[model samples]
Target: MSTDAVLVRVRALWEGLAAVPVSFSSATGVSVVVSPRALICPPGWMGVVALQGEAIVTAPSSGAAVAIRAAVARLSADGLVDPDLLGRALPLAEVLGPAALAYVDGDGFRPVSAGSLAVERLAVEDSELRQLLMVAGDQDAAESGLDEITSPAFVIRDGGKVIAAAGYRVWPSRTAHLCVLTAPDRRGQGLARVAGSAAVAHALEGGLLAQWRARASESRRVALALGFRELGAQLSVRLS
Candidate 1:
């Protein structure tokens, strides 16, 4: 579970999600492939994943792939995944992401400082955890992806109410895609770090590569605190 090993697994995951054969390389600058079956994207959506000094553009059509490949030449390998820049440079009607994509192995994980806060392992479908997500509202709930986790949740409660939770969905290649949530009123209190740390520890014990995709700075900070290294970014675009 060295840094290099994690990156290799991540690259394979992305390539499989691309739905078409594609070779990503730092030497190639950017590689585009046409795949209507792009599993990482919604139907008709296109995606770009940049990692380890390489980039891959997955488009539903060759025409769109050609256009994106052309525009990305003017963009840096890292910038290829920036939604704002991609939206402007391409014929994008809507965009998602520019989110940080990170991963960690057992060696890199930093356990949480639980202190007085109690962390518990609960079912991913726990009723209390669902209530916590409802209180967090729609946008935050969706961002957390807590409802989609396949692993048990690591939760923190306050005054008998669940305030924060973290877990992961098993993705292809035995990757654990992390999902973490903190109550709106309970953020900035390190609850996320503690819950997320527990989840990471569980994933590592299960021999899964822990992955964290963070859009908010606070979320990114929590991931970093848990020793996840931000390797790249991901963007999904709907063509006009």
Candidate 2:
């Protein structure tokens, strides 16, 4: 299959999940209101379900329409939904497909300085940044709806222009996942690492554990460098 075709399928799946209305919390000090209307799931084995708000989902609800809602409610009441909320409730065995959690070891990773780049937290005021991220890659093009929700983000700027960005859709559990992008012109400068570190420190300050869904090789390298270990893998079913 062509690369574009693969990306299209991936985007569709992620958008579908993100569209689900489910509240979530993370150990990275990120909280969001993941209304079904504003969900943006990430594609591939990341199993990223972009939600808004600070709620947890435990068990699938009785009705299909409200199953995720029920899950979050159940998890929240049990108090198992705090700090690494998703990790505690959604085990890889249950949430991911076979081989979804597979990854290679990433050694020789190194941390970067968080302050080397000019970073700014994005808010509703930073619509341009959102727009830029919305089209950062073909995958993002498939999930364009991500622009509708305003999550906390950090941008690396060069001479008043954004060169890279990293953001988290916080959940109640004090953990947040890292979503980063570096502009084509700024790849080698370690802008992603810098912005990512800033995001991690932000999460740590909030008593959250920062997590990210990365490609096997990329994840191994970045996570190891940032002190993150393999949690599990999330698999995707290609539509054809």
Candidate 3:
């Protein structure tokens, strides 16, 4: 199928799956689906496929086709893909099937202190933060349609540079997904917890529930710290 056709099919599948309670996010038009204990993606894509138990996929409308096998490997590592379903999706070997691997499961959300971090709402004029997000991972935050809304962003700054960031992607249901990112050099400093709390508080202020798909351990930690409860796990697969 043409790339456009493939994109349409993949997005359709994502929409269908997201209708469930599982956590999911999309960046640059690519979708990342997270179950309670795992992460998954479509057949072809690339970039920070997984982060702190979360997953990211890339499906650019104009780039060369991504490796289906690599994409499956990323998803399978978290046990997000179903081998049986994957086999049916791609009848051809070149098309690749979902890969499977074992992963560790842990905490979800717990309570956190809102006063520990400096929180600020983001605006379109905040180009520096936007730039920081765009390069933090394989996904580009600036282009993620996040800036188009009045969604608030909470950030942690060290000196003049942003050390960490968190924000929400509000959906039509008055629910908002929590997205957090910390600079590689700034991790291990409790920045995630601080920024995450700010994001959660913002969601609560807006009367929206904060949600995210996390890796087993990270999920547990964030959920426990943020007062998020476990929903359930999800299994996803892509056909060739």
Candidate 4:
């Protein structure tokens, strides 16, 4: 898809998630709106998604939205979604993200080269999936989103032990939100890229847009290797 078409689809997804109409453009700036029903964050939280050259923000009230708009007025699209920068700019009790938002269309996906390792497609309920998560530990497991995947998992094993896996959950706008995790001890061996390739390929073959949100540098590198393009960022905040 062309960049313009990709932007349109991304905007539509956020509009639905925020439960509010959002306008995105090549025009540079941030636009904020109040939406208590916003799905971008839990109730009573504020959310911002920046893409292309603009940002769409959702806050708890008109007053709060206005304050966010002013605070981010002089910031660039990338800066608008940086959690640390936003924390400094606004009165916040907590900041939750600044995850890099990436996407890949069917044409852009680059599957990793075939190696000796084979990917096994397994049901989400497979005990191996849970085992992989347990070994990954709390923080890594939560960040991977593996526990929430909706599709079959593409798993990799080492000597009969599950070591890595990847999958996706269908989101609004036919988007496939990806989840990839590698056993901490099995990382740096390209296992993530291999597992992620299967998941991305499956999502694309199913005609869904593949979306990867990353905070870790290793995860970002894997996404880039799979031909995903980093187009924006998303941040969630709780105001004091």
Candidate 5:
């Protein structure tokens, strides 16, 4: 995509997310706060909790505006979404995606030397080769899916197999939506931290925010280990 095209797409995305208002009351009398601007969700997914930093928004799947307001009122006068209470509000709520706590910090990001990990940049030109290395039995298969990307990807090799991977989905070019996958057998070996550092370093180097929206419980360890900070979790779901 051209620079102008990227700028246009990013601007439209930001505007869409900003249009949604923050609310807490759902028609179900649940208290929650939501970003009215948050537009990311799956089809038929009525309920959602949009989160960014301290900013939050909640909308019941039922599309009840009153529920959103009431939920917020139940939470507090300020009406901020508290992730801990989200489950109690909608415990059975089918998660539309990997419901995760969002963590991000730039205090320790630096250019990573490949080291003994043999980290390499996986570019779009090698999509065919990348697919061959994307093994489902690799352990982190559940989380390793390259749906799309704007930045060059990163990976670490062990023996001859790809043990870990890192990359970002660029939106607005300001925040890099980070992605990572490590073979379950190779996780504790610090391959993820090492490969992730390279990806993050490149993100910061390009003047982008290294956004770490981690989902897996163990993912926090990798993010924090790589010098990222906990920002909070963003929750969303597709109402059954």
Candidate 6:
């Protein structure tokens, strides 16, 4: 559960949160292409994925910018951290490109935290899974792999329709990359947390590290409620 472990998987194109290896690194640098085989990446752009004191840098024939080159060299040379130097060399927005800081549970398993709402994992065979995906507007993951979401894809229903959903995609590291969705109409009802909690419970049962990476402040709140610790920020960025 250490941050280093999480970063290792991510550097290898595996998502600690998604619990799946990114088919390819789509989050390429703004101007360079690190890996030619990566998906959704243009022909050229430097890319960097940094976390847990490790930096994974990819570029076509190395990056053109001297600042980025030096910064990457520094990260490679220094195993420890100096927040100021890192801040100067690798600003998150600049380096990670609109990246987010997140919390990872390294010490112990966090219990589910949603209140009294009932949340059950969605079954691919059930019509509710499709309905939940439609209501939550998350057709990409939930819809494409309804059966693949079996371990802990959960949805909370209101009047027999889905209102909120949460689940984890398992990774090679046994980390559960959590996904939570709630219908716009159902906001402020605490249903996101409720559904999320159930998914975490299932992740714990399978002995997965529950990783919560938060892009929005609202997601951070839910992770905190679930007892995840705020680790330092990491970026999968495209260089400008």
Each model's lDDT? 0.88, 0.45, 0.48, 0.87, 0.54, 0.54
Sliding window of 10 residues with minimal summed lDDT for model 5: 46-55
Instruction: Give the TM-score of each candidate.
Output: 0.95, 0.49, 0.52, 0.95, 0.69, 0.63
lDDT of 3 by residue, 1-240 (tens): 233333333333334434333223433222433332222333343212322244333332122223443444544323333445434433333322232111111222344665646666666358867766666765434323345445666777877777677777764445565667777677667777888777777676776645554544653565555655443333433323
For candidate 6, report its TM-score. Answer: 0.63
Give the clashing residue pairs of candidate 1, or none.
none
- 33 Cα displacement, candidate 6 (Å): 12
| Alpha-carbon RMSD to native, per candidate | 1.4, 13.8, 12.0, 1.6, 6.9, 7.4
Cα lDDT of candidate 3 equals 0.48
Cα lDDT tens digits for candidate 4, 56-114? 88898888887887887767767767766776778889777888899999888999964
How would you encode candidate 6's per-residue C-alpha lDDT over 118-211 as one tens digit per residue?
7766664577665656655554434223345546568887888877777776755666767777776877778877877777877777767676
lDDT of 5 by residue, 1-240 (tens): 333343343333433543454332235333333433345453434333333322334454345445555445556322233444544443334664334433333545544556656878878447532553465354444355443557777877766666677877775547777777776566677776777787788777776766666667677777777766554344455433
* Minimal lDDT window, size 10, model 1: 79-88
Better of 4 and 6 by lDDT: 4
Tell me the spans in candidate 6 whose CA falls farther than 4 Å from its real position.
1-45, 52-54, 60-67, 71-97, 101-107, 113-115, 124-126, 138-150
Best candidate according to lDDT: 1
Task: Kindly list the per-residue Cα lDDT of model 2 for residues 86-194, writing each as its tens digit.
Answer: 4443433233322111111122123567655567887634866755664477664222222332356677777777777766555433335556676655666667678
Candidate rank order under lDDT: 1, 4, 6, 5, 3, 2
Candidate 4 global lDDT: 0.87
Off by over 4 Å in 3: 1-111, 114-116, 139-150, 215-220, 234-236
* Pairs that clash in candidate 4: none
